[model samples]
Target: MRDPILEGALRRVRDEKARDRGRRGRLRAATSAALAAAVLAGGLHLGRHSLPAHRILVATTGSTRMTTTITPADGWVRLHAAVDGIDPGERCTLVVTDSHGRRYVAGGWVAARREHTDLDGAALVDPADLATISVVTVDGRTLVTTTA
Candidate 1:
């Protein structure tokens, strides 16, 4: 014969254990869903940047070399350039020209003791309307030019 009080206590403990198991199962499902979502998002992010884009060789010199990789996104062309042989504390400007002969300029100063500089500048001109992009010195000497 079973003791009535002990039987009730054991039944209560079993019910509590069942509830804890259910909670643990739900937590695992939630964690798995979150991890899958994160992986998918990461893949999409990499896919956007991994696609082939236009790489235009802008300039090649013994002392300095530059190249522009133009990636089309939305309605505009994104410009990225790697520049070298720039003197420290020198002022440099980026110029972009449209087919209509309008020029856009982005200017910045180089760092001290830095011999190489990487420039990133964008133009509002559409990829179709872009004529040329160039990096020029303050005295108007062209350093790098990419024609579209």
Candidate 2:
């Protein structure tokens, strides 16, 4: 019942639509690949140079293990520590003591207990002034201590 000319035109239009969908699919795949590559490159770059190279490991009396790392960046002494085996909701303070016995409280936080926790802060004194770095509980218990 359809005219020949109209049917031919409809077929051509459907073909064009199919071609557009294929083109779009290819473009979408390319865009996704490009985004994934960019993310991987950024992550590698950050992982390579973001932290310091020197680290000291210390074990706490509470059965927690910690590693202290010192990073000197932008004329600042950055003290960082990684701790594991902390109880969920437990509060702890990161303490930095200078050779002259001056104490600086970098920061404190409550553990989320996700198997490990990281704590970091900038020391007000020079890197050479650091004597001992320790993580202590609110009850004056030394969780971990490392001499600089």
Candidate 3:
């Protein structure tokens, strides 16, 4: 009861539809992957900007070197310094100077018998007005100074 020509035509149409469905499925998977990658990239960008930026300064004088990282927040600044090449057991001071010649002592500690000493200090000064950061000896000898 079926015409051979009509049956052949219907078979071709069904085969074409199956191929089209496979293509569509592949395209959908690709689009989903692209969208997920974009969302992840955007999230990383936002997270990076949400954190405070840290400014690092390093200086060396003679055999002494000082590296300082400054973070400003809420009208105050925090400083983390690593000092090297100073003699062990020497008392040292971390000094933060403003552009107006005002000095704020961040913190102080005795040098340990190690390769480097790490010090943490905070100052009640605006970060924009920071001028110089110095590591000085207890008797007023400057070990190193870095300009901010």
Candidate 4:
């Protein structure tokens, strides 16, 4: 009986240690996954211009917001964005998505404060006709606006 009692105490201690070790392993894995997700998001934001061309809008209003606007069926579409607060060497990307979720990268560049870019693309779809439009910055800021 004394030997059996000693064996039980040692087994309980070993089980507790094993549980602690597994818990720590899971915590480390979760932290790593979260970090990987953040890195991927930042990388995607930087490469937003690699997609095909589509039209979008950048409101010249205060605290400039990007919105969708209609343009002539065959002409230039101007995009205005306020880079006053954007740091030097920073770039921005504007993207548009169709009803099928295919992405079109309309524009990407660096510019001075209160600048407008005249996007001269071939016969293009009007922005007001897009399913969704998104504007993203190099710092990973994004805004998605849907059309009627």
Identify the candidate with maximal TM-score: 3
Model 2: per-residue Cα lDDT over 6-111, one tens digit each: 9999999999999999999999999999999999999999887574555565656567887877875533468778888878888999888889999888878899
Tens digits of lDDT, candidate 1, 18-127: 99999999999999999999999999998875535675766765566667777765556677777777667666787878999998774454535446677777777777
Tens-place lDDT per residue, model 3, 4-69, is 999999999999999999999999999999999999999998886553688999999998989999
Model 1 ranges off by over 4 Å = 1-52, 111-114
State each candidate's clash count: 0, 0, 0, 0
Query: RMSD of model 4, in Å?
Result: 16.8
Q: What is the lDDT of residue 30 in candidate 4?
A: 100
* lDDT leader: 3
lDDT rank order? 3, 2, 1, 4
Instruction: Score every model by TM-score.
Output: 0.55, 0.56, 0.64, 0.37
Predictions in order: lDDT: 0.75, 0.80, 0.91, 0.54
Superposed by TM-score, candidate 3 places the C-alpha of residue 107 at a distance from the truth, in angstroms, of 0.6
Which residues of candidate 3, in runs, are more than 4 Å off?
1-52
Q: Write the per-residue lDDT of candidate 4 for residues 94-139, one digit (tens) a residue.
A: 6656556666666776645543333322214443345655556767
Clashing pairs in 4: none
Candidate 1, poorest ten consecutive residues by summed lDDT: 106-115
